[model samples]
Target: MLSVALGFAGPALAWPQSLREGLFGSRPSDGRQFAAPPIARYVSEDGDVFTLDRTQPRPLLKFDNSFEVWALTPQPAPRGDTIYKNDLGEPVLRATRLGGITIFTEQRPGGSAAALAGVGSPLRLAIMGPQALLERLAQASARASRAARRLIPFEAEATPASSALIADSAMITSEAVVRMTKRADSRHFLDRILKVRLVEGRKASAQVAQGVLEVTVAPPQGLAGRPSSDRIVQVAETFR
Candidate 1:
C-alpha cells in the first residue's frame, strides 16, 4: 500500500488552494528548497521508498540513502482537463484536481513493477483524499450511466489477417473506429475495455458477437495521433 502526506496547515485552508501553492508556488519562508515535511511518499514494488516535496517552483523526488534529487515540472494535460501528464510525455503520473483535494495515479508501461523502476519513472502511488475519492466515484458512476443509456449493439465478422472485427456505419468516425481497434489489439482485454470506458466514456460502445466484433462510436474528439478520415476509412474498409 502507498501512503500520502498532505501538508495541510489547518482545516480552514482549502486543499485546492494549498495544493496549487505547493506545486507551483515560490520558495518557502525559511528559504529552503523543500517544505518542512513532504507532500507525499511512495513505496515502489521493489520496496524502495521515495518522497515528493514541494520545493521552490517545482516538485522534487528524494529517495533514501541518495542525496540526488529528480525535479519534476508540470506538463499540460492533453485535453486541458484537471488531469495533467508529467514531462515524460507518456502518462507516467496523472494529477487531477477535483474540488478541494487532488488525485494522483502512477501509470507504468505494461503496469509492471520492473518497468516502474526504470530511470525517471513516475512514482507508483495513488493519493486520494475523501473528497477526491468521492469525485472519482461520481465520475465513474456518471460514465456507467451514460454507457448504459447510449450503448449500441451490432454484429460483424472478424478479418483473418488482423483478427480485427469490422462494423460499417457512417455514425462512427473512421478515426474513432481504427483507434478503438488498435487499442483492443495492443492492451489486455480488461485493460482495453477500461481504457475505452475512460477515454470514450459516453462517446463509444463496443461488443463481440459469435465470431465478430462490433463497435459504435461518435465523432472523433481528436485523440493524439488520430489519423484523418480518409486514411482511417480506407483502413476500416480493408477489414471487410
Candidate 2:
C-alpha cells in the first residue's frame, strides 16, 4: 500500500494535507532562520502522497497513509537542487529549483519524480478539536507508560487557560514522550522519569530532574506553537 520506491533520478517524497500546519522555527531556540522551505503537498511517481514542512531548523516529513513524522535537514546538493536528510545523515529527499523532487530509498537508489499535488496551509498548529487534545494526552501517556514499564503521567499548564496553542504544545509534549521511549538509546531515560510535565513558553525546552521530565513549549513557535514531536524528544534527551 505505502511503499517508498524509485531511484536517485526519480526521487519521490511528499507530505499530506495533515502536514501543512507546520511552521518554521528552531531546533532548540538557536535563532537560525531557514530560507523559504516549501510547505507543499506532493504525489510520488508511485502514487504515494507526502508532505513537507520546515517550520523549524529541520523539515518534518509526512505521509498520507500514516501519521508518523520524520524530521529532516535541508542540505546543499549538486546543481542547485537541495537534499533533505534525517539526523542520522541519511538522504531521504532531493528537490530541484523548479519544484521537482526525488525521494531516495533502498528500492530506488537512483530516484523518482514527484509532482505538486495541491496547495497546503501555511505553517501553523493544526486546528484540532479540544476533545482530540484530551484523547491524545491520555493515549500518549498510556502508551509511553506501557513502553517504559512504569507510569509516566503526562500533564500540561497553559497561561491563557484556553489557548489551543498551549494545548497543542502539551499534546506534542506527550507525543514526544512516546517518541523518546520508542528509541533504544532513549528508552532507558524513561526508566527514571516518573512523569512528563509541559508548560507554555516562547521556545521549546526540557529538563530531566527529580524523576520528572519538565518540558517548556513555545506557544507560537515550532509546529503550531508547540515544538515538533522530534524537537521535544531532543529537548528531553539526557546526557547521562
Candidate 3:
C-alpha cells in the first residue's frame, strides 16, 4: 500500500479560445467552467506503471502487464522530500541529500527500496586540469594505436604505457577501445585515398571534483567522404 503524491501545477500560459475550449471543456450554462486537472504517470524500475490524476483527494491507478487495473492507493509521500517524477510526471523516485552521499529511494508496492541497490563499489577518476585533460586524451589515443597494432601483429611493437592505460581505465570497455582504434585506422585510410584532411573527432572528456564526476562523449562525425552522425553520450556519477 505504498502511496505517493505529486503536485502538478497549472499551465503557465493561456491558450486560444478554441484550443482552450477543447482542452478545458465547454463553458457551463452558469457561465462558469472548471479546467481539468493535469494527470501524472510513471513506470517503476520493475516495470509497474501508474498514473495520478488530481481530484478532491488524489487517486493513483496502477496497471499490470495486460494493461488491466491493479492497485489503487491514496497515500501521499512524506513532505519535504524531493520526488523525482517520470516523463509522465508521476513520482517514481525520491532522493535526499545526507552528509556525503545522496540516498535515492524508489516508490513501489508494499514498500520503498533504495534505487541504487546493487551499486556498492565506489567509482573513482583522476582530477585533471585543461592541460592534463588534453594530455590524457593524447595518451589514450596513442594507447589505442598500439592496441590496434596488436590486432595486426606485424605493424609496430606495442608500448608499455599504452598497455598500462588500457588496463587502468576500467571505466572504458576493451571493446569500445578496440572499436575506436579501428575507426582511427579507417580514418587514416580514407585520408590517404580521398586526399582530404579529416581531423579526429573528440571522443570523450571527463572531469572529477568533490566526489562527483561527469563524462561526455561527442557524437561521432564519420570519415571525410562518408559523413555520419551518432548520438552523444553523457554520464554523471557520484563516488566516495
Candidate 4:
C-alpha cells in the first residue's frame, strides 16, 4: 500500500494536441512515428499533471526558486570530480581536484561560465541570476588576489556565535550594492563588521558573520570610523 502511493508515474502530454503540435512540430496522421497511449486520460485525487519518466532517478530538488541548479553527489569526471546537472537533462558543470567548480556556460542558458567553490560555494540558484553569478565571481577574484592585504575576520574558534572583525579592506562595485546585515549572537555585543566603499566615493557598514568579508575593487577614504565599534581591528594581531 505504501509503495503504491509512491508509484512511478511516467510522462504524459497534458497540453492539447494542437499546442503540442505547434511546439514540437506536426504529429503523424499514420501510426508510424506516434501512437496514443492505452490510457487517453487519467484522473487522480490530486490534480497535478504528470510528465517525464518516473522510474529514472529524478534529480533531487537541490535548489529551486526562480532559477534551478541540481547537483548529484560528487563523482569522478574526466577533468575533476563533481557533476552538476541543470533543470534540463544535461550536465552543465564540473568540480576539479584543484578545488573549483567549472560551470559550462555553453551548456547553460548563456555560453561558457564557471564559479569557484569556497568563494561562493553552495550557490543558491534561486536568488542568483547569471549576471549576478558573474559579478560575484569578479568580486571573489578581487578578494582572492588581495587576500594578503585584505583583513578577513574569521572567528578564532567555531561556535554558534563568534565575532571576528577586520578593518580597511572591503570594497564593492556600484552595481552590486546588495547589502544585508545579520546578528551572529543574541546580545549583539559581539558582532563582525564589513566596510564597503563604492567607486564613486560612498561607503556603508554591514554586521555580518566572521566568514563574510567586505568585497570591493578600490579602497575607501577612511576605515577607522566606518564600523565605529571597539571590536574592529586594523591589522592582524598575530603578525605583529
Query: What C-alpha lDDT do the candidate models reach, one value each?
Result: 0.32, 0.59, 0.28, 0.27
lDDT of 2 at 130: 54
Name the top TM-score candidate. Answer: 2
TM-score for each model? 0.23, 0.60, 0.20, 0.20
Q: Which ranges of candidate 2 are over 4 A from the true structure? A: 1-39, 45-48, 53-61, 66-78, 83-93, 104-113, 121-135, 180-182, 222-225, 235-237
Which 10-residue window of candidate 3 scores lowest in summed lDDT? Answer: 224-233
Query: What root-mean-square deviation over C-alphas does model 3 reach?
Result: 20.8
Tens-digit per-residue lDDT, 112-229, candidate 3: 3321211111111223343443343444345444554532211111133222222223113222334434464333321221111112125433333442222332323111111111
Model 2 over residues 7-124: C-alpha lDDT tens digits?
1121343333332212221223564432334566666667677677755566776666544456577899887888997644678898765455777754676876665654444333
Cα lDDT tens digits for candidate 1, 1-240: 111222211122222234434343345677654322325543444445445544334454545433223335566554443222333333333432211113233333433221111122332222344444334334433432343333322222222211111111211232333333455442233122222211122343444333233343332321111122333333334342
RMSD of model 1, in Å?
18.2
C-alpha RMSD values across all candidates = 18.2, 10.8, 20.8, 20.0
In model 1, the runs with Cα more than 4 Å from the true position are 1-38, 78-92, 98-240
Q: List the residue pairs that clash in candidate 4.
A: 103-114, 105-112, 105-113, 106-112, 171-215, 171-216, 172-216
lDDT of 1: 0.32
| Candidate 3 global CA lDDT score | 0.28
- Compared to the true structure, candidate 1 yields what TM-score? 0.23
Model 2 reaches what TM-score against the true structure? 0.60
Worst 10-residue lDDT window, candidate 2: 1-10
- Backbone clash tally for model 1? 0
Q: Give the distance in Å from residue 240's predicted Cα in candidate 2 to where it truly belongs.
A: 2.1
Of 2 and 3, the candidate ahead on lDDT is: 2
Ranking by lDDT: 2, 1, 3, 4
